[model samples]
Target: MSVFVTVVLFLVLAVAVNADIEVDCGHTEVKVRWSDPRSQMEPSLLKLGTCSPNSFYDGKAVFNVNLEDCSFRRMVTGGQVIFLNDLTHIYDPAFSQPVVCAFERHSDWSPPLYTPKFNTYGYSNLVFQMGLMNADFTGPALSSAYPLGSLIPIMAAVYQSSHQPLLLHMEECFAAMTPQPQPDSPVYPIITNKGCLVDSKSTNSRFQTRERTSEMHLLLQAFKFPLGEDVYIHCKLMAWDPEGLDSSKKACHFVKGHGWELLDDPARSDLCRCCDSHCMARRKRGLASGQGVMQKTVLGPLTIIDGSTP
Candidate 1:
């Protein structure tokens, strides 16, 4: 009987895991229904009150909110856009406030920028980090050399991986590793938008750092020959600006020329296991890799009065 009970419990757990969750945001007139992409489930109740002046709404997969003045702001997986209206609300003070919000899936990565909120008057925090992945970080030093013809995926933690969370998009990206060890800089090949686009409002929403690690995965496999040298990885992160304004001028700084040792050993050897089969599979599929793998985990309707909390 105990064994049978255990089997029943396992089956129940499996079914629950496969079950889909839906979100329905409504008040009296407007209604928006959204279901989880992973499963096909029915809609459930999810009420969204007045969001704070500047905060992100994670209650629904895709949603649109009607402002106090009847104007609306829509948040969808495709992207986010704002529609301006002339007549602002006089009775409902919410409309006049500098309220800007985005609805995105939750993540473990730190916030993208360290600013007040996504839609604040002045919010700018753009930075990224890179590091090597070894089975044992405390064990003997590991080699960065990867086998020739194989792909090297260097994990990158952009804005969302920092303590500061700001709203920004991944305008551009590039990675380079030194083939031959030396002092003078070598011309490293440039790549763009290869992996995930680190953006707060994009479908690939950058999440809090404590929840996720390495928001971007960069693949390096441009070397034509297996040269014997120290492999150094350098990555650059740029901010995405939709309004066609200067990103740097707006404080959306770009990271460039920063280098990190990918593989420390002088030569490639058996001691080095610097390859990712899953990453290789992703490359083979060609684009659309990790589409929904790394998303923000929804806890509940989070009403953050202070958007500038570490």
Candidate 2:
């Protein structure tokens, strides 16, 4: 009977001590220790700190921990990560705020971190087919036609690469135009102000990524410009990392794309003119038109911040 009781107690103790454990690589508020075979044998070991010398090059850090473990796979597949045993807490105050985690795939080169990238293909029409005009007109006459009170849709889509998800918090966005007589000319006359016609309008507000990318669209019906003049269109966007907004580093990303296509009649220059305000509106209404996704550009590359780790 004593032996039976001892066996029961041992089983209970084993069950209590050896159980599957989860460590959220994305976010962890609790203390954790490494459960790998080596770390398990030496619970006190901390492995080498990720801050050790030569840890990062070209914005990517080589973490000493093996990412092939099931826990890592779980983290990539699912936001919440579960490890085999108690493990040392993984935390990088700079990167752990809201817990943004992403892994490298065999596909394209993954940026050091997950970031927003613009969809240039969707913007083709907005940049190329914005206006219709003849190429031969040269004098003071306007080469393009326009109807009053026309509205143009300016739009873009953004997505995070691979399967990693991201939540976007928009900060600011605007559309501007520069009118020039010739595409090669260095000087340009301003025809529109910031934000195009909706200077006070807000954007998508906020959005999260899924199997696909998120998008933003704007109706530009608020501009007063000379009819028949050719112009260049440019859009600039900025989004903030909600958790890192106050950081002095690159806490936000800026994306930009331009729409400028020279007509076949205009000597094939690189300038696209806007249709008369009312003309574009009637065209869309007539069609009842339905429509409707990159090299990842990093803000760090342009900013003074050195993303490389020492």
Candidate 3:
């Protein structure tokens, strides 16, 4: 009788422990953990599966959610669903086709973090495609709505890579509901780096004038971002001429990159070396001429902050 009682108590404790689930979001990954008392010895049993004929646990079941599906927008509290179709106005045709996942409870959606309203001098066309752990999404199982608890991690990874600011346009969004930074507050810091330029010109007889010119290379990096929170990096470029003549105007260009992309490829070794080199060379020559030709540029990194499991 004592042995029977002990077994009952053990079963009860196991069930209690298995009911809780914890999710962790990292710079480049998301992890979901849960306990299952029914098959404590076989963790795989808790994974998504279908029930078999005449079996209690063998029925057709889906675990992941499609990020694009209307159902997902309804499930998430105060979540706003932005489809590729809606982004075409601000993005190019190539970008118009990529998938995007956005959730905000704010009354008004802010311009893109890197790309802001044109008058605001920010990049306005950055977008993201939904996938699983940087892998291609093959079906509904891998969609953002899937129950894999992987979304947070994936978001964190993207933020870590791009460091581009994430604007929580929704006031009541999950991140905003918590005591963390408010949607309108600038809680994170913006890092700045030096800009370089390159130029080639030849002196002419009876006439000396500068005509054709190009910009030099510029690079910037940012770090230490909160998980699941929006982040942004802003980069701008300014230039001047050899005769100590600054351009009558400054040309501003912005590129939108994500933290997850940075975390996924932190080394940034995948950048186009050939194009970068040309840009850098231009900056170097412009500076060497001592003619006053210089360029100033900025890069913005943004993402949201969230917690991770130890």
The lDDT leader among the candidates is: 1
Write down the TM-score of every candidate. 0.25, 0.23, 0.21
Q: Would you give me the overall lDDT of model 1?
A: 0.27
Question: Can you rank all candidates by TM-score, best first?
Answer: 1, 2, 3
Candidate with top TM-score is: 1
Q: Which stretches of candidate 2 lie over 4 Å from their true place?
A: 1-146, 167-213, 239-310
Model 3 per-residue lDDT tens digits across residues 1-310: 3522111100111111123333332221223343434422333223311111121222221123222221111112343423211111122233211222333434443322232111111111222221112222112222121111222211110111332232111000111211223567544322111211111011110111112222111111212345434333222333333232111222112233421111112244232222223222232233334322221111112243322432
Q: lDDT of each prediction vs. the true structure?
A: 0.27, 0.24, 0.23
Q: What is the lDDT for 139 in model 3?
A: 23
Q: Candidate 1 — which residues are off by over 4 angstroms? A: 1-127, 134-142, 159-185, 192-214, 239-310
Indicate the residue-level lDDT of 62 in model 2.
26
For residue 58, model 3's alpha carbon misses the true position, in angstroms, by 63
User: C-alpha displacement of 247 in model 2, angstroms?
Assistant: 14
RMSD of 3: 22.4
Which is the better candidate, 2 or 3, if ranked by lDDT? Answer: 2
Question: Where does candidate 3 have its weakest 10-residue lDDT segment?
Answer: 198-207
